[model samples]
Target chain A: MASAPAGTLYRGGEGMWSWVAHRITGVAVFFFLLVHVMDTALVRVSPAAYDAVIATYKTPIVNLMEVGLVGAVLYHALNGIRIVLVDFWEPGPRHQKAMLRGILVVWLLLMIPGAYFMMIHTIEYLFGSTS
Target chain B: MSLEIADPRSPGAVPSGRARNRGNFEKYSWIFMRVSGLVLVFLVLGHLLIMNVLDGGVQRINFGFVAGRWSSPFWQTWDLLQLWLAMLHGANGMRTVINDYAEKPSTNFRLRMLLYVVTVFIIALGTLVIFTFDPNLA
Candidate 1:
């Protein structure tokens, strides 16, 4: 099988970025899930141990990291819903572009409010309430 | 799924196929993968940094730490987003792989239905856990 030229478009409708993202997110989530479960199970270890674990979350940088986790999970969830519809339903291919746009708009809308709440709470927690 | 090369010069080789029908669903799925992938990069990376690095590292984490964080609405929402997004993104990706590979319609249907059930169940259960978490419970 001869390799195609560098810029040639593949025949299938599937986009490369999406496929890569899906796989990457899946692996990341799976890894985190293992760690999360193990950490949560620490509750059974002792109150002192559990408290020690929770304290690490207070660092400002850690809060920043939470922002990324939220973003990853949001993108993955929204796109996953889109994939589900495509696979199970045999709709005409023409509508693919429209559906993609719709997914993007929906994701943006949801994330805005979700992120806003996260920020407000973070600020309140870090700096003693002014109001 | 083998790709066939169409010959333009052959007498009988004039394309016989009709214009491909553009399905709305597929377009959306394609778009979704790109958008989701871009976002996942940031989220996953951020999560790793916070959990493994920054301020006393992983050793300082504890129940009071979680309680303190969640006591604020901010962390709760952050966590909520993470749970929902990751699960949905992963399930969607799996759906794509299934569609591309699954041959039998019945098998596809059964597998998808099962996937839906499990995905919904986990999402719901996770949401509940996040909201109802008790910091004081011994």
Candidate 2:
């Protein structure tokens, strides 16, 4: 029983997640882009109106959401780089896994600094403190 | 009286060479779709809730609002991460679509090359914008 392969549990190779992430991110980014464009276009209507819309982002909940957005972008960027490598260069399967791991490490390193800065900036802006 | 192996290319039969590679690539692609899809669900929903539902809602957004937000290192980082992840993910997905559908080698090469170029351009432009955004530019 221990050795038996479960029909429901299939172990796929490394590239699978990357591919799925690609599509999901693509759709998401497209939606966000549409909204962003529309919102920015609102600037043409009136600065006051635009400022009203922008001010909504200052809420705590929205700040939290921005964190998630950061994560998505980081993951997508790192994985996209991996996919590009695999597609154009055709790296070996073993190398591909290594590459994926490498991507994750890089993401971690970059994300830490990115998050720190963003946090500091947010805190300063909301609290009216330079610290 | 015939012992001929069935040619996979016959009517209703799979094209052996093409079918084999397609099957292999697709197996990997299916796995990717599942994993990325799950992550994306979280990333996207979180984004929507924050931008549209939180605080005073969409009405509060503006240049000064953005400046206020970015003044915090938090939003800057958040926007940065969002930019990189979404762009890369979208590009990779498109790469798969191109590989699966594009027939000619040259066509595939050109299309992919263009994709890479565009992806890089956007990423660079976005990063620059985030880091260099001037909120006081009147």
- What DockQ does each listed candidate score? 0.11, 0.09
TM-score of each: 0.50, 0.48
Count of clashes, each model: 35, 32
Query: Please, what are the lDDT tens digits per residue for candidate 2 over residues A95-121?
Result: 677888897888788667655544554
Q: Every prediction's TM-score for the first chain? A: 0.74, 0.76
Q: Pick the candidate with the highest DockQ.
A: 1
**Per-residue C-alpha lDDT of model 2 across residues B9-113, encoded as one tens digit per residue:** 686675566455665766666556545545554665466555544564443556766677778897788777766666665666778778888989899989989
DockQ, candidate 2, comes to 0.09
Measured with C-alpha atoms, the lDDT of residue B64 in candidate 2 is 69
List where candidate 1 sits over 4 angstroms from the true fold.
A1-131, B1-23
Cα error of candidate 1 at position B122, Å: 1.5
Candidate number of the best lDDT: 2
